[model samples]
Target: MTPPQVVVVMGVSGTGKTTVGRLLADELAVAYAEADSFHPPANIAKMSAGTPLDDADREPWLDAIAAWARERVEHAGAATSSPYGVRGVRGVVSCSALKRAYRDRLRGAGPGVFFLHLDGPPELITERLGGRQGHFMPRTLLDSQYADLQPLQADEAGVVLSVAEDPESIVRKAVTALERAAGADNGSGQATG
Candidate 1:
């Protein structure tokens, strides 16, 4: 059987990472994690005050999320499942992993970790942020997030889904893409493993 998959729902702020990630987790029948929960109190306070976190401030937070991912994968290691019906011990996380280095840190968590990048126009995201309430990440830092965003590269196990579609459709697309990626990786001569 294929190993369990850890899907990282990644995007800049206001791209519906949490909403879509929760629905995706439900669809896949996997445990869900919110990356914001891993943020240190100081980081949260800084963001709440409209301060963007430097890489120095984010390393620990990213490492915490990586540790959580590794723990979940380890706990699910012995679980078995067939190719049909219920899948492997899947897990989903929503994170604003806006740079390649950050994504590399997440990839280090374990095997079968893939990314689902929710991407859309800046205007659309800005509009969504304006309407959102009670989030530490404010609209003021949107530009920095965009500047930091580095799309999944050729070697990455991931797919980019447009936010123009509804959440259900996006999740569906993600599942299909993940299945294809797993298949490709399992086939002969596939470089991804």
Candidate 2:
């Protein structure tokens, strides 16, 4: 059997990471997690107040999320006992792992932790962010986020999908890429979870 997969759906703000990650988890029959939920209240407060989080402010949050992913990978069964686990299955998470170091921290959780980068034009993302409501991340921060993002290297075990297409199509392409990477035979894509 293939090893369990821990997928980190990563992108700048408004790239549909949450939406795509959730759908991909559902398609893979696994749990979905939101990395934003793990952020400390202080971090949220800073972001809500229009201040970009400095690396110092983000370390704890990143470590916490990585630990959560680690727990899921280590204890494949009885995942319900902890939010960190996936309830007897694999899982996906939406995270803005903007740097290689951040991705490396998450990868420490397991060998199968793969990243999926959602790439799209700035105008497209701006439009999407504008239509959203009540999100703490302001569209004004997108430029800062873009400036901070370090694209995944070619050697990394991950795939980047364009976000210009419709949501369903994007999911389909991601699942296909993941399935091919995992070498699974199931229709939805290989069981990376």
Q: What TM-score, computed on C-alpha atoms, does each candidate reach? A: 0.89, 0.86
Highest-TM-score candidate: 1
For model 1, residues 123-190, the per-residue Cα lDDT tens digits are 99999999999888989999999999997887677788999888988987776676666666453211
- Please give the CA lDDT of all the candidate structures: 0.81, 0.78
Residues 1-193 of candidate 2 have per-residue lDDT tens digits of 2333788899999999999988878777777899999999999999999899998998888888888888778776643212222223368899999988888888777666778889888999999999999889998899999999998875466778888877778777766666566664333232222
RMSD of each: 3.6, 5.7
Error of 2 at 14 (Å): 0.3
How much lDDT does candidate 2 score? 0.78
